[model samples]
Target: MRVLAFLDGTLADPDQAHLRVDDLSVLRGDGVFETILVTDGRPRELGPHLDRLARSAAMLDLPEPDRAAWERVVQLVIDNWSGGSEIALKLVYTRGVEGDPNATPTAFALGMEIDEKVKRARAEGIAAVTLERGIGTDLMERAPWLLLGAKSLSYAVNMAAVREAARRGASDVIFTATDGSVLEGPTSAVILVRGRTLYTPPPTIGILPGTTQGDVFRAAERAGWQTVVESFPASELTSADAVFLASSVRKVTRVHTLDGQPLADSTELHAELAKVYDSQYD
Candidate 1:
């Protein structure tokens, strides 16, 4: 099942929700968005997602989103949701019609069921390959206009990387910077386990800061594990005790194989980590 709501506190049929043909979002992918995981009709970490949405909009020189208004839309979707246990609630804000100075922005919220494939990944783990991101680690610092950390709608390159991974017989990808530093997955954050510590690349290296990663780290810390934010080369992944990808919808999934090489079985560790992650809802 799916539900749709507009930013103006109005509900709409998903099939009827439409945008102008010349909208910047359609013309040039000019906008920002966030996907929040809704469990039992409640959105998780909603505030952080909205904050990131505004941050991304600002990065694109778009007006800051009206939080209260957006929140109302989210509530509308939740109220109308008749789905199962989980839903991927997406909030989208776009630059409106092209060449229309009087045009206002387009915004909406969509709630859809989580795909079975995503659930399978969470349960059975995934195989991933490392792909070159074609940008130096310092590019974001040198050029702020690149919008490296923003979750904008411009995802053609990211999708292409995923397709490349599929072509390589992998289900996912771990993007590596031109300088050989590990960045993140196209739709998730990378976490490496070594000893009793968890390591993830810092946001300064041009990756979307993972909200789920932050939650997992906090959970891990409370469970007597150490978490660090630092950048390491792709080679470090091969030597790590275990590797996982963290995202809002998927939460966390073990990387069973990387570049066709099998990784250590961390089933016991994965369960413990998953336990802490689930404890947040309690």
Candidate 2:
């Protein structure tokens, strides 16, 4: 991974920086971030990415970085290219050091070569299990201070679940409420397909609204495909005309199995939807 750390208006290497854990971003996880897929050497759905980033920043009540400045940094990182069409560009902003010593959180963009495994999973559908419990809404509401829908540095819990899913022989996990309503995955947004229509858990479900989902759904409409936002139980998913997960990285992948049960076939839909999506973004 090649890094260009943006610290107080200067770009430096992470190893050379005096970054510490005391920063509020580190101490309290007070920050917002985004993972964007670089297409044609550019960030796909950049507008939506910025929109979500701003919304996340507002939710966290953290200092907001100028979009133009940040966008330049990303472009610089790409122009300084080390030669990988598939690059994972991540922007992390924090409130700086927590204590007096390392007080200000230094923001930097760390870029890495996209993993071949993730690419393969996009081409080949993944097997996943439905999580029995979705994240609590009360924490996000009552504690309005909580990260909630914001993509913050506090991702330990989410990463843990994804790791566990891999350990269990699945590519990812789809979160669901105790009542069986599906939500989202650890890193990707959830999108379920039925016939030519596409459905996903609404943002109101306490899931991070997905940019990729928005892109495809709009593309689906342009391509004459049906798209809807509504609630459905896990049992209904078992009977879905087609079930798949969508994200910028994974694109559109049909979910073939869940909890030892073979899921329905949505390969043709996946292909058609993939065309509409990939034509614009991938």
Candidate 3:
């Protein structure tokens, strides 16, 4: 469904907007972005999403969006959204229109409806394949200036990884490194249950520091479930009692299989966690 676009402050129709594809955000993926869920016309975890949006923009050396105005834009989009049970509100700030690296920055905020099938996947669990895709420690060894943790606009690689996983008959990819250390997912956060302890990779290891996962941890604590963030190899995942991917839109979804091996269902915990997450937005 189509929604209005808010660039800096001006509003325009996305279908007729004049956003340049070759802008710095497109050419170099030099931008920071956030995807917040809109539930019943209200944006979920807006404060944290804006917090990270600014943080990510700072990391990429891009100008931050005006936080107060950005929030209003999201609400406006929710109000204008067409067939929305819920929608994904996205705000993007880029080091502007294609030019020298020192050019001015451009930014935009809009809402996109969450795909219905993806929403359905939350009810029915998702299958995943492990992709040996880790953000290497040596940024200088690769592109030092690129925003590693920033939700930069360069999604080609991430899309490719998801496609690779889909090729293996899985819905998504759980990334790992050459050394077997498990990382986050192509788009979602990786969450695994190790019997009593719930484990996720720490942000120190080049993860996006998931805001939704952060809430889940707090909720788990309230639910009397143990939560921990530590680094471990993907090999450890095979032995995990259950696995799932978490995100604002999907909420919390079970991972039934990893590389063809079945993972025990964590339906009970998923339900418990869902209630906690759903309550936050409500």
Give all TM-scores, in the order shown.
Answer: 0.98, 0.90, 0.91
lDDT, candidate 3, 1-282, per-residue tens: 767666555667778846678787767777778888787887778888899888887777667668887877777777677766788888878787775667667766777788877877888888889987645644422664655667778888999998888789988888886567788886788888876678898866676788888878787777678998987888887778778788888878888888988877777767767787677556
Give the local distance difference test score of model 1. 0.91
Q: Which candidate ranks first by lDDT, i.e. highest?
A: 1
Worst 10 residues of 3 by lDDT: 137-146
TM for candidate 2 is: 0.90
lDDT of 3 at 156: 89
Q: Scored by CA lDDT, what does every candidate get? A: 0.91, 0.75, 0.78
TM-score of decoy 3? 0.91
Tens digits of lDDT, candidate 2, 8-36: 34556645745665667767767778877
Error of 2 at 90 (Å): 0.3
Question: lDDT, candidate 2, residue 266?
Answer: 70
80-109, model 1: which lDDT tens digit per residue? 998888989999999988999997889999
**Runs with alpha carbons beyond 4 Å of true place in candidate 1:** none
